[model samples]
Target: MPVLSRFALLMLFCLSLVLVGGNSNELRAESRPNVLFIAVDDLRPELGCYGASHIQSPHIDQLAASGLLFNRAYCQQAVCSPSRTSLMTGLRPDSTKVYDLDTHFRKTVPDVVTLTQQFMKHGYKSIGMGKIYHGSLNDKASWDAYPTVRGRGYQLPETLAGIRERTKGLDVKKMNWRQRSKLTRGPATEMADVPDKQYRDGAIAEQAIKSLRELKQNQQPFFLAVGFLKPHLPFVAPQKYWDLYDRRQIKLAENRFPPENAPKFALTNWGELRNYSDMPAKGDLTDEQQLQLRHGYYACVSFTDANIGKVLDELQRLELDENTIVILWGDHGWKLGEHNGWCKHTNFENDTRVPLIIRAPGMQAQGKTSEALVEFVDIYPTLCDLAGLPLPAHLEGTSFKPLLSNPQRPWKPAAFSQYPRGRVMGYSMKTDRYRYTEWQDRKSGKVVDRELYDHRQDGAENDNIAGQPDQKRVVKQLSAQLKKNWKGAVVPD
Candidate 1:
């Protein structure tokens, strides 16, 4: 066969090796960073990283170590649907008119591009898990492909186990006139018995890992969002996490009642129904029950932390951490007896304030905090800027890339929030030192309620200084600013 045949074969082998090496390098060079967006439902900044004494969120704290932690971040609306819709679409609730669960955003912004859609348009495989949208029905069309195993959500603990059997005898619809109610706590025996090996949070994290693994093999850019349904309601979690908190040692609010100078217009009826149903007018909940509920809330937070830890671990394991961007946010804050409110349906800080953290490779500021006034709408432009995409023309939010790059930069004078309706219509202008709100009855053109608080002076916002003669000028100034920013649209109550 001779030397000539052998030399030809050697040259062919060498060419194949060179081509393979070049292709591998090309894959590495073209690899766009992955994105992991985590959204929590009804979670306040109650974690070790956020300076909370009761909750444990080490995983999130570590993630913050690699990213930017927003100190004064807020949601557009306090409720789930409107808040989430505004954030996802990069539009205000008034602009989109998505005030309730019944309103689909497609109706408002039919041709509008969603964050997921924008990512997809830019060649990223956008995937949504759990409650990305307000409802489960519309999730499929929004995401590139919604997986049944990883994308679906679960019911709360009340429906998770034998509690379902216990609750069968009790009807949420028919149970009436109960002055107060309580949920008993015990070992989380159902954790092992749940059909899926993964808990709801665990399932989401695991699927995120799986998606990353698939991207690793295909060499494609990915945008994966994991939505954790925790610290929300019924406060159910594994018993081990419950054991972490001492119920007897829990601290109640110092100002349990309304403030001395609280204005009538500053009044809110948000949690009245929950108060009538489950909260006792006088000594309704036992000491044990109160502690147990607090324990459950914290436990759920820890459980969520563990799930976030899992996804972070996977990102590192896949060697995608350096090139990936991570964002964690909550739809809104929940009121656990704060201001006598159990849920978010008001314009107060307790109901509207949420946690928002972003971790971007090469762009992240390690252990930095930004107090810049930001809205949920701003998330739209922020993500677009991060991905090197053009901002949408219709977005009302201003991009904060400059501030993100430099945390100490000056920002807007105040963060604006609205609750638009006839009499409930109000505007909340929150600055570093004050939160001013004016409630008006639209029909009669009458000032129904006015509120002003020096946040530094009253962090909890228990006192109202709106009507004080000394503060009248300040109120008028804020009123003028409110009129300037009013979007002139009605949001359904």
Candidate 2:
């Protein structure tokens, strides 16, 4: 062979060896399992799997069937920012010091490592989409790539016009998004004729699918967090989702009045719903209006369920289902006219209880339900435990990884949640039999009001029997447990 030609062939062989070596390294990184973390906004435990046959949530029900569904999961706080902050930071609301929507978790705990950030530190490619961290308060360091797609909250032209008319002479540019939204709000419900992709949740699903396909090509295990916004305020969804429910068949909440003998602060004014253009500011909704709101909420849920199905289908299509840990959770539960409340603000069962499902690869608890008490704060450590990563010392939650296998095993004694109303804080503890709450004055730390509902009888929370003569012993025991708080409730390792 000619000398120049021999040299060229030798150079090409060297380049091929380097390419093969790089590919091998990528394949090694793929040994760890991928994570598909799903977050849904304002979703309660209202679904077919949860025995709410009236709701058309086939996709969520299917997820529950495949995963281990928690029958009694609760959130740290029944609001967006605080609950999400607690879940992501593995801390309670009091620890995080974030009670309202405006305050960011990082403001209090700036150096804390979030759930996604912990995954990122372990060589997993973390990506977040949609409403993951409650509106625009995102942790930039937690993700490798976090892209956002903006869309109108309402779809119809009439709704857009109504908003414009409502805020005609106001300077919207000077107002923040929340303030502007309040001033230029449309009807509480909208059923528009549009494709699924036209909405934000639908668009988020498409983005997630695309990311999954791209991640399939890359050998790194990914932590893809997709958050869907739906079943929330000003319920807006495609007309087809609305068609899934017959309005006449939808019934109003059975217990529409406040709890008997309960403190006034325990009930909410549902100011979130009242801000809508069509809602009444200070009175009970008309029967027709209540039905419409229920119908809209159900439609929004079904719409979100369909979007979730699309993402899950894509994951299965890419053959990632076998090695991926899929977790679906709601940030917090919402009230559907229970106890004369329409939003999540109080520490009531309707507002605190959320739907949680976890489908880990090769888990023994597949297609099973766990009645164990779990809290949102436990999510951070549980994921860490599943990934074989060391738990952060700052984490305040217990890992319920053992329950994934033996779900019937004994777990935490109670799930704790709290809500702040002005100067008072209502701390609630939910055990197997009852939910007990104490409204304490923040300034002096004095128990001003108390609430207790025996779930065995008053599941709807129609009556507060805290002051009853016969339940003194029960209240005293629960009060002692409440004082113990989460630290006392944590299960042994």
Candidate 3:
């Protein structure tokens, strides 16, 4: 053959390769599934799938069986604002400078796209209902179209009309010794009868089902975020849920009575205990009352589970289950009297560890469990990867694609969380088996709280063996890692 003919043949071969690669890319993009983003507030890993002995969460368990359940997932911050901010923006709490409930991540990453924004940019219709973000005051702009009437999963029926009023009468400011004593212990009320249609959980379910139905008819894919507000404080639920679990069956948590094994300074940062009038503070709530409160919490969880079931049922009914990616994540873990703490704020597992489940259509293997150390910040990149969307340049989290596909795949060795004050030296660190926190008192030098726990032995974090001679080596190694991996060292303006 002549040289010219040989060159022509080479060009043709190269062109064919290019066409094949391009076609493959198109196929992957076309096959990407719609995302059903489910966010729950203040939930711990108390689901049946996560091996909770008592609490019933059949809906979530079923979802987990059909998806990937992350066992050792940690939030960037053990509070709502920072956790949600990090999750939404794919930035760490320190990097975003959103350390409190009052501060939003917008100040740091003003032009940054949220998970919803990214999905919308890629031709997906984004809709959010209920408590997706941390909203104590109001977030009118958070959703695309927040209904004038409370969206589903956020209302109480007329039958329980006085529930809100009862919640309002709870006073936290009266933390005087007498008040704490008077409030401790006793049964308040049974789950009692309440109209199902009027409850917030039911409302959220109705709205989500409606949205799923509408989305099924549309040609465009959607990113529908259904947020459930429950298992949080003032754990109120329809009486039916409360009756499901007998109070005697409620198992006592390791450290439920009050603040123990915690520094006084650490306890001071717990504003929720002081702020939420409906919640019990230290020395308040007798053992029986504590049980009642806990009963309410568990019942609310079941109530939330039922609501989730409704949305899921709609997805199947609409035949959208095959093409949708479902993800259920709690903003952060709540402290149900763990480590002598009552709520999330500390870096303890009960506070920082949240429940994260992802079902990526046919991409994920059913009934898989991943123990990979993942952070809430990783949510952004994982979703982008699943959708074949380019991850924004500013995202700080790595996609857990490998781990999601194969649950036993090894990944990050540690997770990070941060807590900052307006002017204090603040606190931040990397955590694994050891929790290394550095607290700075404006006027004083940095004080380090290095707690080392053999998770194999101390899953409850009952003992803080920070200064133990035998654990010094482990603490030193973790300290070095903490400094090396500290992503949010500088405070954002």
Find the candidate with the highest lDDT and give its number: 2
lDDT agreement of model 1 with the native: 0.70
Give a tens-digit lDDT track for model 1, residues 244-363.
777677776565565557655444554332332244555434555555556767877888888789888988998888888789999987766666545677777877788988888677
| Candidate ranking (TM-score, best to worst) | 2, 3, 1
Per the 3 Å backbone cut-off, how many clashing residue pairs does candidate 2 have?
A: 0
Clash-forming residue pairs, model 2: none
TM-score of 2: 0.92
Instruction: Assess the local accuracy of residue 384 in candidate 1 as a C-alpha lDDT between 0 and 100.
Output: 72
TM-score of 1: 0.82
lDDT of 3 by residue, 1-493 (tens): 9999999999987775554343322223345578899989888998899998698899999999888899888888888878888898888876777777677666666777888887666667878877777764234344465543253333334423543444356774566534542343222323546665566667877888888888888887788888787776556677889888998888667565333344444443344554444444554545675677678888988988988998999899899998888999998888665554566776666777889999886665678888778888888988888777767888888888777667776577777775554344334443445555555554664563444556666667666666678877876777777767666222112
Worst ten in a row by lDDT for model 1: 179-188
List the candidate 2 regions with Cα displacement exceeding 4 Å. Answer: 1-29, 167-173
Q: Candidate 1, after superposition: displacement of residue 418 in Å? A: 2.1
**lDDT by residue for model 2 (252-350), tens:** 999888899999879788957998889987888899999999999999999999999999999999999999999999988888888878988989999
- Best first by lDDT, ranked: 2, 3, 1
Error of 2 at 57 (Å): 1.4
Could you estimate the TM-score for every candidate? 0.82, 0.92, 0.83
lDDT of candidate model 2 versus the reference: 0.88
